[model samples]
Target: MEKISNFLEQSRMKDYILKTKLGESSLSTVWKAEHRTTGEAVALKQIPVAKLTRHLKNCLECEITFLSSVNHPNIIRLLNFFECEGCIILVMEFCAGGNLASYIRRRGRVQECMAKRFMQQLGAGLKVLKQNHVIHRDLKPENILLSCSECNPILKIADFGLSRILLPDESAETVCGSPLYMAPEILQFQRYDEKVDMWSVGAILFELLNGYPPFHGRTSVQLLQNIKESTSLPFSHLVLPELHPECMDLCSRLLSINPDDRLSFEDFYQHNFLRT
Candidate 1:
C-alpha cells in the first residue's frame, strides 16, 4: 500500500526509462522500463487516455479493478498506475521469460510432464477467475506469460482487455476473443457464459501438448464451419501413444462443441490429468 502511495505522489512519464519494446496492440504498448531512483525493472503499459472510447475505458476499468483485487501467483501483478501526459501508465512486475506463444513456437511440442505442469498452473489461475465470476473472453498462448528465462518459467495470465464479470447463472452476448482460441458458440454469435473460457483453456492445453491449436480457419466463418464439422481434436499421432488416458479425456471434455457438454470449472480443476 505504501509503495502504491509513493507512486501516486512521485509518478512521471520521465521517471522511468523505457528499454525494450516488449509487446504491442492497437490499444496499448508494453515496454521494459527501469525506474530512475531504484533502478527497479517493470513492464510499463501505456494507453492513450485521449483516444479511448467509452467501451474501451470501461474495459480498462474492468481490468484494473480485477487485477488490483487479486493476489495470485498465476496471475500477473499490477504494481501501480497513474495518469501522465495523455496516457494512463500502468506499472506491472516484469516477466523476463516472455509469453507462452513465443515459448510454444520455439519448443514446438513440450514433454507430457511439462505440459501437465503448465496446465496445472493455468487451472490455478482459472480458479481465481471462476471464484470472482469473471469471464476472460480472451485466453490464448499470447496472453499467458512466463516468469523467467533461465530456469523453468512460472505461467502468469495477462491481457484482460476482453474480460467481463458474468455470474455463473447469467450469460453474455459479446463476440470477442481470438478466433482460434474462441469457443464455437462465440463464433456462431450465440450467447455464451463461463464455458467459453473452458473452450479457450482446452485450446491452449491442446497447443501446449501438440505445438498447434486444436482448430483453425482462414476466417471466422471457415473456423466455425470447421468446428461444426470436426469430430475429434487433432492430436499428434506420435504424441498420442505416450499420453495418459486422463489427459486425453480432459482435453476432449474441455473442447466439447456443445456448451452443455463442456467441462465446468470445478470438473476441470479437479480433473485427474492434473493430479500428477
Candidate 2:
C-alpha cells in the first residue's frame, strides 16, 4: 500500500484537468481526467481513506493487485494509482461510450444481434479473467463499460470492488453479489465458484431479449422468492419471437435454479447464439 502511494507521488504528471464526473456509488466517486503530457484521457476512481473499513482497505489493496495482473482489450485498463490528501485515486482508461446499464436505460431494448455482440465481448473478457483464476462476483450491466463510439461498443468489464482471485483448490463460501442477478446458490449461501457469473450472464441476456428480467417484484423478499421459484420465459415469447428456439433454451439452462446445472463458461461460449 505504501509503495503504491509513493509510486504515484513520483510520476509528476503535469497539467491535468477534471473533465467531468463519470460515476458514483456508495463508497467511491469516478471522475474523467486528461493527461497533459501524453494527451490521453483516463478514469479516476477515488476512494476516501476515512470512509474505508479495515476490510474495505484490504479489498482495495486486493483490487490493485488484481488490476495489475489483468490486461485485455475487452477489460478496462488500470493506468495508474495515486494518493491525494487522504484518498486513494485509481487512474483507469476512460470508457466514453458509457456503461451497458445506461445504454439499456436509454434505448429500452437493444437489437438481438447487438445484444449478442456485447455478450460475446463480455464472455471474451471473462475468459481472460477465468484463465487467471479470478472471478468477478458482480457481473451486472452496470459494471460493463463501452468504448467511445456508439457505432461499435467495445464491452469492457469494470469495477473489481467485489471480485476475488480463487486459488487452484479453493472455493468461495461467502454470499456477495447483486441480488437482482445473483445465482440461487448464492442466495442460499451455499459454496459456489465461477459458475455464479454464468448465471448473471444468463440474467443479463434474458433482460436484453425480453426488456426485463424474468423475476420482478416490489420487495427484496419477493424478488428472492421469484428468483428461487421462477421459470424462464421461452425465446418464442420474446419481442423478437423469430429468435431461434435454441437461443432461448440456452438462456433457460444458464439461468437454472441449481448452480450445479448452470452452463459452464466453455459451454456458454459454444452455444449456437454465441458461436453463430
Best by lDDT: 1
Note the Cα lDDT for every prediction shown: 0.90, 0.80
- Please provide, for model 1 over 39-88, each residue's C-alpha lDDT reduced to its tens digit, 9 standing for 90 to 100: 99999999988778887787788889999999999999999888866688
Can you tell me which runs of candidate 2 are displaced by over 4 Å?
Answer: 1-15, 234-240
State every prediction's TM-score relative to the real structure.
Answer: 0.94, 0.89
* Counted clashes in each candidate structure: 0, 0
Query: What are the runs in model 1 whose C-alpha is more than 4 Å off?
Result: 1-11
Clashing pairs in 1: none
TM-score of model 2 (CA atoms): 0.89
Q: Model 1, residue 195: what's the lDDT?
A: 95
Give per-residue CA lDDT, model 2, range 1-276, as digits (tens): 988765666553334567899889888999888987777888889888899877677667767887887788999999878777677888899998898887888777777888788878988998888887888888888888899656788999898887777866678887777888887788777888889899899988877776676676676577778776655553434475656677677788888877678898889888888888
Q: What is the lDDT of residue 233 in candidate 2?
A: 52
For candidate 2, the C-alpha RMSD (Å) to the true structure equals: 2.9
lDDT of the structure predicted as candidate 1: 0.90
